[model samples]
Target: MKSYKGRGVVLHTLKYGDSSLVAYLLTDVGGRRSYMVQGVRSRSGRGSKLALFQPMFPVEFEGLESSKQQMHRFREVRAAFPLQGLPFDVRKSTMALFMAEVLYRLVRESEPNEPLFDFVWGCVGALDAMQEGVANFHLWFLAHLSRFLGFCPGNDYVPGAWFDIREGLYTPVQPAHTGVMSRECSAILRDLMACDVRLLSDIGLNRSQRVEFLNAMLVYFGYHLDAISAVQSVRILREVF
Candidate 1:
């Protein structure tokens, strides 16, 4: 088997039997793939390796690729960069869970997408380094991620205009569909779409407003992608932020 080196963002992992793990990661070289890592769950020294597979953790790995196998094997795995804050901070950690779950559910491609990989990798670093806009970070992430997912919202906002979630644009005339966002929520969404990730601190939302906007954005996402309507971490995220 040919060994390949790659960087990836850990999306999810599950225990395999009692002493191993099956990890799903979105890689720079192979897009999304599952790796069957042996003995990571053991009570001895290998248990520490489990930390490397946490949600949204970025890692560099050497793996053996086999055309015949659905689940690949990792020769070695280690963190790509040390995260200063994400794992220790409760709020950021919760947001990481939400981000990871959303990515796992929506990104199913096996082929590599360099632009998307770079965007996600950069965002993971951004999230770790971020300090001021912690509350709005996930919303910022989702807004930017939509560009990669092919349904980035239109930023043309006018007074009294509603956002047509189904159409992915701002409309002066109210959309008859239930997927339309009210003027207030539309204005917020417009701001979210227009703001850069570095400027997330400038956009402020109260808890209710944040929840409402997140629900609206998820609805917008759900309209375009199947099975994204129910992200399990969303409820926990709402309570945390």
Candidate 2:
């Protein structure tokens, strides 16, 4: 068996039998892969080395060539970043789970996108390093992801123009559709596309406004993404914000 090593972001994990784990990870070189981990339920399973469900780990794996579609096997794994406060902090942890779920849904298997991978890894690092006002991480991430996913809405919303949600374009005519945002919401969304991740917290939105913005983004995704559903994490995010 040939073996390989790379930095990976853990997408999700499931209990395998009683003492093992099946972890889904997105590695920089290998793309997405599933690896079985053994003896994780032992008394020594509480620390950094086997942080299977958490993102941002450097993984060493053995390559099994029996099948082209074979699942990757991990020989070792460890955290690349010491997440001091993210797991313990409620808001940060919620953001991480929400983002993880989003990535798990969005990233396709065997798709090699170095730029997108780097972007996601950077977001994880930013989430860990964030000191305050990290509530807007998901919103910013969604907006940035839209750009990469090729669903970036037109930033040409006029003062009196309505957003064309299905078309992903801005127009002067009022939308015949119900999902389209109002002129004010359209303008706010235009601002979102230009803001940096840190500045996202400075957008000065009320809870209602934030919800509207999120809904608008989801509507855009629904038009673009085939299997994307309503994000369940939005409710938790709203409650937190």
Candidate 3:
């Protein structure tokens, strides 16, 4: 096996045996990779390492890789920074879960994507610092993430036009297929297309509006990426906000 060092965010983890676990990560060097970590669930001293695997936590790891193995080994893991709010805040935690799940399904590259990694890392920093407007954060995050995924739904708001989910663009008329968004929600998306994430707290939304736009963004995502059938964390997120 070859050794490499990189920074990554934990996306998902599943129990492997009684005390071991398998984790999926989006890393700066390896993109999306899985690692087998033993003793993460134990009452022994090794269990303390579990904190390094929280969703959306920025961490640096040294990895042992080989072509013959489907999962690699990561060691010497350390948190890049302490997240102030994401781990403690209920709404932000739910948002992190939903965003992580979306990324887990969408980010499939085994090669490096420097810009994409930077985007996720920066957004996580902003999410940890923000104290308000948590509801709109995920909406903006997905809107910007779509850009990196190559299906950026551009903001082309016509007076009576629809945002075509399948086309990943705007249209003057309703799309023939079921992949479309109304002008109102499309307007919100248009605003999000250029809004700075640091100002996510400034974006205002009622509960229903949040529900509608989030669903619209998911539909837009579903049209481009078939793997994302549903985002389960959204249910708890809706309740928190």
Question: Which candidate's lDDT is highest?
Answer: 1
Worst window of 10 by summed lDDT in candidate 2: 57-66
Candidate achieving higher lDDT, 2 or 3: 3
Please give the lDDT score at residue 37 for candidate 1.
92
Return the TM-score for candidate 1, rounded to 2 decimals.
Answer: 0.95
Q: What is the C-alpha RMSD of each candidate to the true structure, in Å?
A: 1.4, 2.7, 1.9
lDDT of 3 by residue, 1-241 (tens): 8999999999999989887889899999979999998777777665467887888889988988889988998767789898889999877888899889889988899999999999999989999999776779988998889889998866556666788887777888788888789888888888888688777767788888888888888778887787777657867766776
TM-score ranking from best to worst? 1, 3, 2
* Overall lDDT per candidate, in order of appearance: 0.89, 0.71, 0.85
Q: Please give, for residues 114-194, the per-residue lDDT of candidate 2 as tens digits.
A: 877788778877877777557666777887888777778865656777778777888888877686778877877777777
Ranking by lDDT: 1, 3, 2
Error of 3 at 235 (Å): 2.1
Best by TM-score: 1
Number of backbone clashes in candidate 1: 0
Off by over 4 Å in 1: none
Please give me the total number of clashing residue pairs in predicted model 2: 0
